[model samples]
Target: MMDKMMATLLESLHEATQRLEQAVAVKESNPDDWLAILDEREELIHQMQERFSAGSVLTEAQRVQLTQIYEVNQRLIPLIEGCKQGVQQQLNNLHRSKLAMNSYNEAGPNGYGAFFDRKK
Candidate 1:
């Protein structure tokens, strides 16, 4: 029974990893679509956490697969970080441009001023 549970969890983990990788690729071209992938990944993670909390024993093969998953995650971390940084940079640029436009659009001292009666 434990072996079967472990196998199922392992399969889910593999599927999540594959989906995440696909998301990473799609993120550059179609970021909106990537959001749905992230949602699915989040749910898979929750399910995996529940299984771990249930304290199921695993066979040696399952342990090896888990280790492989860990290794794959290690590789994925940097790619995800790069994607995050790119998104942040885009946001910063957008904010700066918005500020610049607001400054340009502001009504700057129309010809008549409070000081007009005081001096040349």
Candidate 2:
């Protein structure tokens, strides 16, 4: 029984992680889709949390399996955080690029001297 519960909890955790990843992907591809994914992710995470808490009653083997899950999650969390940061950085860079492109477009290619001009 406890083994089955632990398995279910692990599966839930995996699903939640997948949902989170999908949300990140959707946000990158289509910003408007992010809200929906966020909603789903929240729901899945809540479910996973409930099951994980209940998994405290697991037996020795199940406990070991749970510990392994924890270790894997610990390793994965930093990578996930890094991925999120990378995505945010990419978005920031893209925004800056767009702004720079617009500014240059407005100023014309010959406007390079605008920066070096000594006139106040």
Candidate 3:
């Protein structure tokens, strides 16, 4: 039988995983919300590690629950990677546009040309 702390941590992990799934399912999910869920999951995992590393063994059910969490994570990896790539592409495009604008401004006609008016 799992200890109470372990059970609670596992339940929290399960809930975090559900939130992650929902976040991934939405096409326009907020990255901040997804990241918050991930952060919560990481904290729960750390808590579980601290609690379980004291020469404790997991019961079969606990092992199964962990395995399920692992499976869900595996499935999410590709989707997460895709999202990362999309964001990276957007950043790259923005950077290129900024550089182009900067170059254009640098090569542009400065106000010096307008200062010496021919009709002055």
Which structure among the candidates has the greatest TM-score?
A: 3
lDDT of 3 by residue, 9-94 (tens): 89899889988988997888988999999999999999888987865567889889889999999988899899989999999999
lDDT (C-alpha, whole model) for all candidates: 0.71, 0.60, 0.85
CA shift of 38, model 2, Å: 11
Summing lDDT over every window of 10 consecutive residues in candidate 1, give the lowest-scoring window: 111-120
* Residue pairs with backbone atoms closer than 3 Å in model 2 (clashes): none
Clashing pairs in 3: none
Off by over 4 Å in 1: 26-42, 108-120
> How many angstroms is residue 104 displaced in model 1 relative to the true structure, after the best TM-score fit?
1.1
Query: Using alpha carbons, what is the TM-score of model 1?
Result: 0.70
- By lDDT, the best candidate is 3
Considering summed lDDT, which 10 consecutive residues are worst modelled in model 3? 111-120
Candidate 1 vs 2: which has more TM-score: 1
For model 2, state the Cα shift of residue 73 in Å.
0.4
